[model samples]
Target: MPYEVQGVVSRAKGEPVSLETVIVPDPGPGEAVVSVKACGVCHTDLHYREGGINDEFPFLLGHEAAGYVEQVGPGVTDLAPGDFVILNWRAVCGTCRACRRGRPWYCFNSHNANQSMTLADGTRLTPALGIGAFLEKTLVHAGQCTKVSPEAEPAVAGLLGCGVMAGLGAALNTGAVGRGDTVAVIGCGGVGDAAIAGSYLAGARTIIAVDTDDRKLEWAKGFGATHTINSRGLGQNDVVQAIRELTDSFGADVVIDAVGRPETWKQAFYARDLAGTLVLVGVPTPDMRLDDMPLIDFFARGGSLKSSWYGDCLPSRDFPMLIDLYLQGRLPLEKFVTERISVDGVERAFERMHKGEVLRSVVEFS
Candidate 1:
């Protein structure tokens, strides 16, 4: 039987989300039903609520989640009922060119639930990131579930489902930060701080964190930032100069632009040592452009300028490893959860997120 549950839904653009009845169908072929325990409030969910993603109205808005498998549909052998898992947006199809090339992280064709969840009136609801989970239960493609150690708390482990993963992956995977490297992360929010943590874990010799907000900079310190720069009143060159000064008159080996604006990206481009890498992990609006940048700069600066899609992560491989690290206390994953909230508090959580008051406000199911 289909399950009817109360889920947070964005009925229209820019309007506050509300608790609505969501109809989640039983797992069909290659799908699974998960009993969601906790889901994080991320900036991406706020973007969806504001119509930044699309015109897909009435979005079932939550994706950064961890849960137990309640049921599995036909042909799903890897997971079974009671398996603890983190939900991932990208479910790689092995036949895709990227997957065939052994780079499934870049899989062009990812999977979501084959069936749609709906509102009480039978209107189809678009699940946020194809895994609407800000509720008691969710439906997803079987491949979307990545099993991990059950010892980690739901609120902490669920973060690997999105933002935290993006940050860690940006530094470790995309940037290829290594031991004794100098790294700088721009925009010290949850993602930027995660980058700092990743850099620390990778044995980066110096980690510089840049942000306009002092509070976030302090938060960065806890994540292992070796230096902090308040760039609020500084020009782009000034910010770049501060980073260079901190890195022994040379720029960092890797500079990550977690802000995603053209100005921040430019700073990151100039603040890297010659032939150093620049990783862009932040999400930008569609209308944002970089037409003014001189083409010669790209040629003059000889290094990789890469955009990290979900930190270029392979869920099946990364999620379990990260969970184990968290369990062993090697990774401070629990620090990311600023507060635990009831599902109804999500709208308020969005307000606090905009104000930069919390790293994450997770909705915990009773």
Candidate 2:
């Protein structure tokens, strides 16, 4: 039987999201219905509300979520009801070229529920990042649901589904931070802080956090940044030079641009040592164009220039490892959850986020 539940929806850009009656269909082939426990208010959600993501109005707004499996479709053999799971957007299709090449993280064809969850009036709703999770229950491909330790807190565990995972994966997977490596992360938001923490976890000896926000800098310190640069008063060169000075006058081995603007990307481009890596984990806007590019600069600055997608995470692999680290007190996932909020508080959370008021305001469902 199909279930009807209240879900947050963006009826129009720049309009407040409301609780709408969403019709969730019974699981079809390869799908599962998850009873969402908690979801995080990511920048992507705000982008959806602002129509920054698309014209997909009446969008089912949340994606960073953890839940319990309520039902599994006919062909879904691995997942079963009552399983504790973290919902992920990327469900790699094995036949894709990326997956065939064994790089499932770069899978060109990802899967979602074949059936659509609709509005009460039968209007189809577009799910955010292919996983609409801000509701009481959501339908998703079974592959989107990865079982994790039931002991983990829903709020913190759900974060691994998005920003936090992106940052950590940027450093550990993309940047390949190693023992004694000098790493610098630009922007000290939740993602940036997570990169710093990931660098520390990967055994980086010097993790430099650069941000204009003093409060965010403080947060970065708790995430294991050995040094912080207040970029507000300093120009980009000054900030880069300061980081270089901190890294023994040699630029860091890896520099991550968590800010995602062209200015920050350029800063990261020039801030790393010769042959060092630069990982762009921040999302970029469509209108933003690169300028003043010299082909010589690209070649002279050798090493990988990469963008991290969902931290290149395979939920089945990364989530449990991160949760274990969290449980063991090695990773401070709890520190990232600055505030716990109810589902109705999402818009307000975005307001606070824009004001730089919180690291992460997680929505806890009763």
Candidate 3:
């Protein structure tokens, strides 16, 4: 039997989201039903409501979630009911070419629930990032459920499900920031700070955080940034030069563009030392086009120009490792949870997020 659960949904473009009863089907083959304990409000959810992601109306919001496995479908052996898990969007297929090449992080095929959760009117809702999880219960593939230490709070563990992971992985995985390396993260939002913290974890001696907001810069400092640049009073070149000045008048070994925009991308391209890596983790809109780049710039840079998808995370691998770090007090995952809210407050949380008032407003389910 299908279960009825309350969820946040955007019925139309630019309209206010509200609580609605969504029908969650029972676990089918290779699927699992999760009793969501907490879910975080992310910018992507806001983009969906604003019609920024696509024209998919009546979209189910929320993806960064932590929950307990309520039931497991037939042929699912790795997970069972009572398992505490953080929901992951990327459920990698081992047979994908990328996986076969030993690069599972770049898995071309990921998994989601075979079943659909729809509205009372029977309109199929597109689950944001294939894991709409604002509801009290959500259905996803068994592989999407990554078991973590239940001792960790859901509010904190769920973050690894998305943005935070993106930031950390951008630095640690894509940027390959190493011990004593000079690292600069352009943008001091949650993702940027995560990159800073990741740099610190990777043993970077110097980590520079560049942002326009003073509050966010302060937050970056708490997350291991050795220096902060408030870019509001500075031009792109000025910020880049300031970053270089802090790094012995030479650009950093790795520069990450956490704010995905053409201008920022260009800045990141030119902000690094010769042969330094540039990692773009920010999400760009469809209307945004790349042009006017000198083809020589790509070759002249002499290093990788990469975009990180979900921080190129293999959830099964990274989630547990991050959880262990959190437990060991090495990663301050709890600091990212700026506020805990109810599911009804998601719209207001989006407003706070847009205004840069909070890092993450997590909706805690009773």
Best by TM-score: 1
Q: Kindly list the per-residue Cα lDDT of model 2 for residues 287-334, writing each as its tens digit.
A: 888899899989987888988988888877888899999999999998
Each model's TM-score, in the order given? 0.99, 0.98, 0.98
Per-residue lDDT over 225-271 for candidate 3, one digit per residue giving the tens place of the 0 to 100 score? 99888888787789879988998887889999999998888888888
RMSD of model 1, in Å? 0.7
Model 2 alpha-carbon miss at residue 238, Å:
0.7
User: At residue 136, what lDDT does model 1 achieve?
Assistant: 98
Tens-place lDDT per residue, model 1, 1-366, is 999999999999999899999999999999999999999999999999999999989899999999999999999999999999999999999999999999999999999999999998999999999999999999999999999999889999999999999999999999999999999999998999999999999999999999999999999999999999999999989999999999998899999999899899999999999899999999988888887788888899799999999999999999999899888888899989999999999999999999999999999996
Model 3 score (lDDT) = 0.91
C-alpha positional error of residue 198 in candidate 3 after TM-score superposition, expressed in Å: 0.6
**Model 2 residue 302 lDDT score:** 85
Worst 10 residues of 3 by lDDT: 282-291
In model 1, which residue pairs have backbone atoms overlapping below 3 Å? none
Question: Which parts of model 1 have CA positions greater than 4 angstroms off?
Answer: none
Descending-lDDT candidate ranking: 1, 2, 3
Best by lDDT: 1
Model 3 scores a TM of 0.98
